[model samples]
Target: MVTGLKPEKMAYYKQLHAHAWPGVLKKIKECNIRNYSIYIQKIEGKYFLFSYFEYVGSDFKGDMAKMAADTTTRRWWKETDPTQIPLPEAAAHKQQWQIMDEVFHTE
Candidate 1:
């Protein structure tokens, strides 16, 4: 997560994430992404979310492609994409999620 949603929108955002969308959650599981969680720090009424997920599948690219091709996933992105801040590269095109580097992992 980049920045906090507006005060009025925060509640709705929290509500939706409380029980993530079924289709989106299902697609994540299908892609072998597990032990996923998002942490938030609130400062001056602003929220910042740090998310982490384990990738258990062998073919990351293939799985991502499969997820991207899903209609449900596309629709889900449509709903949440507007709320997110894309990186400069991502902003130049249609990217639902951006890749992040893994600095360190114990296991």
Candidate 2:
């Protein structure tokens, strides 16, 4: 998934992730999501964040709901969501991250 980052909030965003909340991290593991990573890049004078993760759970939807219901996760989003700038299409639907289609993968 991808989202644009506010230039002004770039440092703060990285700082927040540097010492991520322990409870939130615990919840993410409990939800069966692993190998998660986020990368930032400057593209055409704009900053964007790309996030990747592997879901090891059977029920993706249910696991997501479970994560969403976690108080710690909700709290983490409160601090991080404001640092993002959703793309036009995603903003139209009130979403923060835009889903990226996987065109090719080899393991």
Candidate 3:
């Protein structure tokens, strides 16, 4: 997934994730998401965030629903969402993270 970072909010964003809430992390694991990672880059004066995770759940939608239903996750999103700027596709889809198709992967 991809999202733009607000330059002014970068510090807060990093600080929050540096010690991410345990409950949020637990919920993500409970939803069968693994190998989660986020990377940041600066290009053309803009900061972008790229996240990758492997989903190992039989019911993707159900897992997502479970994550959404977690109060702690909701609170976490509230703190983090304002630090990002959704891309056009993500905005159109009403999503903070824009899902990207895998073009190449080995292993």
Candidate 4:
């Protein structure tokens, strides 16, 4: 998934991530997401964020719903959501991140 990062909020975003809340982290693991990572890039003076995560659960939709129902996760989003700019596709879905299509993969 991918999203645009606000230029001025970059530091705040990095700061929040540097000291990620314990409960939020725990909830992420509880959702069966592993080896998760986010990378940033500067493109034509704009910043974009790319996220990669491995979901190990059978019911992805159920897991995501559980995550959304988590208070800690909601609190975490309150801080991080403002730092992101939703692409049109994402905005249309009222979401901060847009799904990406995978063209190639190698193990």
lDDT of 3 at 4: 97
lDDT of each: 0.71, 0.96, 0.97, 0.96
Tens-digit per-residue lDDT, 43-82, candidate 3: 9999999999999999999999999999999999999999
**TM-score, structure 4 vs. true:** 0.98
Measured on C-alpha atoms, candidate 3 has an lDDT of 0.97
Clash counts per candidate, in order, are 0, 0, 0, 0
Q: Write the per-residue lDDT of candidate 2 for residues 1-107, one digit (tens) a residue.
A: 99999999999999999999999999999999999999999999999999999999999999999999998899999999999999988899999999999999999
Q: Which stretches of candidate 1 lie over 4 Å from their true place?
A: 1-8, 42-47
Task: State the lDDT of candidate 1 residue by residue for 1-107, as single tens digits.
Answer: 23334455566666678868899999999999999886566778665555788889999999989998999888876766565555556456655345567787685
Which lDDT value does model 3 have at 34? Answer: 99
lDDT of 1 at 53: 80
The window of 10 residues in a row where model 4 has the poorest summed lDDT is 31-40
TM-score of each: 0.74, 0.96, 0.98, 0.98
Q: All predictions: root-mean-square deviation over Cα?
A: 2.8, 0.8, 0.6, 0.6
Model 2 has an lDDT value of 0.96
lDDT at 25 for candidate 3? 96
Q: Where's the lowest-lDDT run of ten residues in candidate 1?
A: 1-10
Which runs of model 4 end up more than 4 angstroms from their true locations?
Answer: none
